[model samples]
Target: MTTIPVIDFQLHAVGKEGCVELDNLGSEMCQALEGIGFCYLKNHGISEEIINEAFRSSKDFFSQPVNEKEKFARSHNYNFGWVGLEVEKLNPERPVGDYKEAWNITLEDHSLEWPSEKVPNFKPSMQKLYEMCTDLSKRIFDVISVGLKLDVMNCEDQYVPATPIPGTIVVNIGDLMQRWTADKLKATKHRVLNPSNEQQRRQNRQSMAFFVHPDDKLMIECLDKSNKYEPISSIDYLNSRFKATY
Candidate 1:
């Protein structure tokens, strides 16, 4: 069975005492995030109802025949909209495609837009979840910064001007951390599974991933003074490895 480690949010919500404990947790969590690129975040402040509702809505949206889901398929950029099973390829180096169906939503400056007309109630439910999750992600990022002994807001820039991208839940990892960790920690690589597969389809499994990307125009490079590692362009790194096949 594939398992993602669960990091408890409560560990960091209570201030100093919490922060202290989380300092220890951060080491383990960062190691997991670096090695696996995915982890199960338990005790996340978001309500179970919200998580279930988001998943339920996603399942309903993907359950519609392919034609219907395609209506909202991302256009222009590879970022937003509905991605069908075997439609998004994650690793260009690997020939096989990913197996999954997903509905992606993203926010910037706390603003969100969803295809409500097509997926009734999708906009509101997702917006609510995004707000909550964003807050949670920020807290986690802070803990990571402290764990690494960098300034409190050292990692803040990566998430400040959020841009949308796919994966089941929101993901943040980019040039900033690459520079900070000297390539020791890497941004996560995640993909949705094609819902058409018998086992997955039978279980009605569908995923929603929200990736918080840096502003499209932003040029991410390692800081010179912090030159603990070789600098690399974020876009080049992402493009070289990620080729969405669904």
Candidate 2:
């Protein structure tokens, strides 16, 4: 029964009090990712209010009729938009596709597509959350860079998953990071399972995720230079995965 580590992000966000513990914080985070490929971050700087608002907005969006959601249906060319239920097969070997639906918000400079007429706050709340997450990710990368003593920056495990802890952010390492680190870190296979109880099964589960990817044109190579994986462009890698998913 191994448990995912819970790292207090306040240690990194704090000023004078956190200076001495920064290295230890990075080490703890690295260990968690290297060992389990996931960790829960507590006391992250993002406001709880923002997180709640985003979820509320997401729920509202999902509650709309399928027709309305289809107006912004995602395209293979543009990855940001409404993604209907069962549209993805994260685990290719699974008999069926994923059961969840999603709405992707773009990180590009283009105008966002939102059902503002229906859920007015959806745009603002999600935008704010996106910005906060972007900042937090940069900080996390900085810590990892120092911890690994590198000059450049870079699981479904068993049936058990990290239990939900209030005010904590669950960070999962992705394929890119695993390759970038030359297997120093892990990118685990995971899937969302249905609730065990009938009561819970009837309710909709709301979750939010912020994916951080390097520029589309950026080339990704193995950081350790061991050639464990071949170098590829960000967009090319994403396209290949999307092909398998859709």
Candidate 3:
């Protein structure tokens, strides 16, 4: 089994061309992402305090009664609010929908329906973590560019779960990225299953996933010069997928 690679993302030192560290980091990141579409990044600059507080906020919001959480329910036209459990079935063939709930956050604060009245810290805590994740993503994109020598910038069945490591964040490529890369990078299928351990099943799992999509108006075309897939706008592609799952 190819275990997920753990990369030391020293963003501060990766810019210099021909540096041994940069080459190695670039090589490792690209290889891991290509092989499994996933890697764990260590030495990433985000502080643990911010991460912990965000988790606390997520837990607080989820702990509320269903009726209460429904107050901030997601709107039909946008994916910027609370999504109840079982409302999403990523795998259509599965007997039941996913056993999880999620609150999709966007950069537009006014567009999101915040649970401020109940969880006062939700907005600030999540927003802080969101910005940090965005910054880290841009840095990772830089590393990928160096790895690919690009002049311009951008599996569930039998799936293996990434083993958690302290002080590391997990990164994975999405379908748009794979399409944009013309399959040079894998968009391996993935799904979260219920924990097997009886004791662990009773516990709540709090996670923050930052979905990075290009601007709605931006076009996504094959960057590797392979016309394997047709070009599509970010909004159109995202809407197609969301319509299927939501």
Specify the poorest-scoring 10-residue window by lDDT in model 3.
Answer: 148-157
For residues 71-158, what per-residue lDDT tens digits would candidate 1 score against the true structure? 7786545556776766766667757656666666544323434556767877667777877766766777776665553322222122
Q: Once superposed on the true structure, which residue ranges of model 3 sit more than 4 Å away at CA?
A: 13-21, 149-158
- Tens-place lDDT per residue, model 2, 1-246, is 268888888866422233454688888888778777788998888878989999999889899999999998987767788999889888878888788899887766267577889999988888888888888988888777767633322233474466789999999889998888887777766677788999999999888888888888999998878787899999899888889988
TM-score of each: 0.65, 0.90, 0.89
RMSD of 2: 3.4
Top TM-score model = 2
Worst 10 residues of 1 by lDDT: 152-161
- How far in Å is the alpha carbon of 104 misplaced in model 2? 0.6
Candidate 2 whole-model C-alpha lDDT, 0 to 1 = 0.80
Ranking by TM-score: 2, 3, 1
Task: Give candidate 2 regions above 4 Å deviation.
Answer: 14-21, 149-157
Per-residue CA lDDT of model 3 for 1-246, tens digit only, reads: 257888888653223234344566787888777778899998888888999999998899999999999999888866788889899878988888788899987767565668888899999998988888887887788788777633322232467868679888999999899889877777888777678999999998877788889999998988876677898999999999988897
